[model samples]
Structure formats: C-alpha cells, structure tokens
Target: MFRAREYKICIIGDSGVGKSCLITYFLTQKFDSNNKVTVGGAYHEKQLFINNEPLHLQIWDTAGQERFRSMTPMYYRNADLIILAYSINSQKSFSNLPGWLLDVQKYHDGDPILSVVGNKSDLEKYRKVETKEGKEYAQSIDATFFEVSAKSGTGISEMFGKIAYQVAETRDRAKQNKTGYINPESQTETNKKGCC
Candidate 1:
C-alpha cells in the first residue's frame, strides 16, 4: 500500500501578479482570463506521485491587495514550500519581492523551499524585468528561480516537478537526520549503511 504524504504550500505576491491564475492553470491545465480577485485566501489540493510514493499538496493562494497584506503571512506560516510569483511585465511587483521574502522569513522558521517565479512569460515581449535580473535576485536570496507562463502553459510542469522532488528530498533528509541515519555518500567509515 502506498501512503500519501501531505505538503503545505502557499502562493503570495503583490496584486495582479497572476498568483491565482498560476494555481488555476496548474490544477485545471486551463487559464481563466476572467478569474475573480481572490479575497482573503483560497485552498486547493492536488495529489501527485513522487517516485511512486503518493503525495498530497495543500496549496494556499493568498490575496495580493494591500488591504489583505496583513492577513497573508498567517497562511504562509508552516508552509512546506512558498511560491513567490511576480509578473514579468510589472516592475513594481518584482521590486516588491524583497518585502514579500522578508515577510516569509518572519513567519516561516522551518526554512521552507522558496521558489521565485517570474509569471506571465507569455508576455515576454512586454517584459520590464529582464530574465537575468530575476535569476540574479533569486540566487542572491538562495532561492530557486523559474520563468513560467500560466497562459501558454510553458515551464509550469517542469517547475512543479522540480518543486515536488525538492520537497521530497528535504523531507527525506529531515527524517534521516532525526533517526541518525548516516548517508554513505558522505561517510568514510566502513560497514556504514548506504543511502537508499
């Protein structure tokens, strides 16, 4: 029997950054141009198979309006992974990323994986933020960077696949450390159990 493990994730950024659209596209594989502004927040669940192991992702999409800013951090608490999305055409959204990152740093103590997503890659012709700039900023903050399009369905699957694998790896490492399981790759001692 396969046991399903649940991982909590949160999406956050300034308003109009396509946070909701990205989630919608990921779940439905279709983008709704008329998606209503997400108030307070919304929850979504997706089941996936990672290395033949059942996995559940509890995705939380938060409102980006200024009025909802104060309430957003509460949802981010205890998240397993946080997707910080910004529009490639909106310099303001990209500029505000640091503040959002700081908010995550304030609320999350477990060091959840941070993914800085440059959304709206379909509108690259109108992009104000350069790809290199986003990559450099993500690197500076020690986070993974992805340029994805909720519209064209470009780079979405690859990004999520990487996220799922990374979360699984983090969980496995935590479990091993907790049980004092020595990883043979880093072990010099003989007769040590090898990493599975």
Candidate 2:
C-alpha cells in the first residue's frame, strides 16, 4: 500500500541568515535578490516526488528578530524537522546557532530531525565560519550539516531530498515500533500508503 506523506519543517536562525532565501529557492528553483525580511513568519509548501511517491513538505519560516523569539515556539508543534541555519559570512549568525538549537529543544515535542545549515555558501571568500566547525557542531548534536548557496541554488534539492528520506525513515521506525513489529515489511498495510 502507498499513500501520501507530509512533513512539517521549521527553519530558524538570525535575521539575515538567508532562511527565507533557502525556502524560496527550494520551492521556485530561483533566487529572489530583493527578498524581504520575514516579519512574524511565512508558510510555504510544495509537493515533491520521492522514490516515485508524493512527499509533501510544509515549510515554516520564522522571523529571526528578537521580537519574534517568543512566537518561534508556536511553529515547533508537530514539526518533523527543524533546520538551524547560519550565514557563512556572518560570524554572529554562526555564533548564535546554539541559542536557536536550545530554543527548539525547549519548545518542540518529542524528537525531530535536526539539520544545521550554513547558508550563503556562494560567498566563500567572505566566509567567517569554517565548514569543519559547522560539521563538528552538527555532530555534537547528532544532527546533519549542509552548506548551501540559496542564491545559486546549490545543494538545495540534495539537502531536502536527504532530509525527507531521513524523516520518513524515522517515522516509519516509530510507526513500526508502535505496532510491535520489528520488520517493517511485515507491518499491515491496511492504512499505510508508502515505502520509506
């Protein structure tokens, strides 16, 4: 049996970490040079095909300003993935990654897949955070790390695709455990729809 799968993802970071640009480029495959800052938050989604099955992504972009910090928790509910993004050119953004990670851990329920992203990779010359540092941080937290260039649309699809697969696999394991089934293939398919 195969059915549609949907995952809600929340993106958080400092004001100019390019969170909105990452979502925009992921959905449209084009960059918006004149992109405006997200005030409270923004919601966008797109239907993607993974392994020949439809996988829907609900992406929530939260404002990074101090005023919006309180509201960030509201979007974390029922989220399957939380992406902590930092700009490669902004040392402050990179420095603030742990704060954002703590915010999500404090507010979000259960366990969700966490991804650490270093955005604006195209500005390599102006990089302030080393890739090794980002990778180390992600490893310390048991999260995935990605360096993406939203402006050039580099590493966007691959990031999302891998995250989607990882989320689905995690969900499948949880579901299987609930059914007291060790082998996923042996699980009943009456209400199921897709393969992980």
Predicted structure with the largest lDDT when compared to the true one: 2
The positional error of residue 125 in candidate 2, measured at the CA in angstroms, is 0.7
List the pairs of residues colliding in candidate 1: none
Q: For candidate 1, write residues 1-196 as lDDT tens digits.
A: 7568999989999999999888888898998899999898999998877655578889999999999888998898999999989999999999999999989998887788888999999997899999999999999987889999999889887787778767877777787899999566333432132211
Q: lDDT tens digits, residues 144-193, model 2?
A: 99999999999998898888877876887898779877764434462244
Instruction: Tell me the lDDT of candidate 2.
Output: 0.88
In model 1, which range of ten residues has the least summed lDDT? 187-196
Q: Go through the candidates in order and give each one's C-alpha lDDT.
A: 0.86, 0.88
State candidate 2's TM-score. 0.91
Clashes (N, CA, C under 3 Å) per candidate = 0, 2
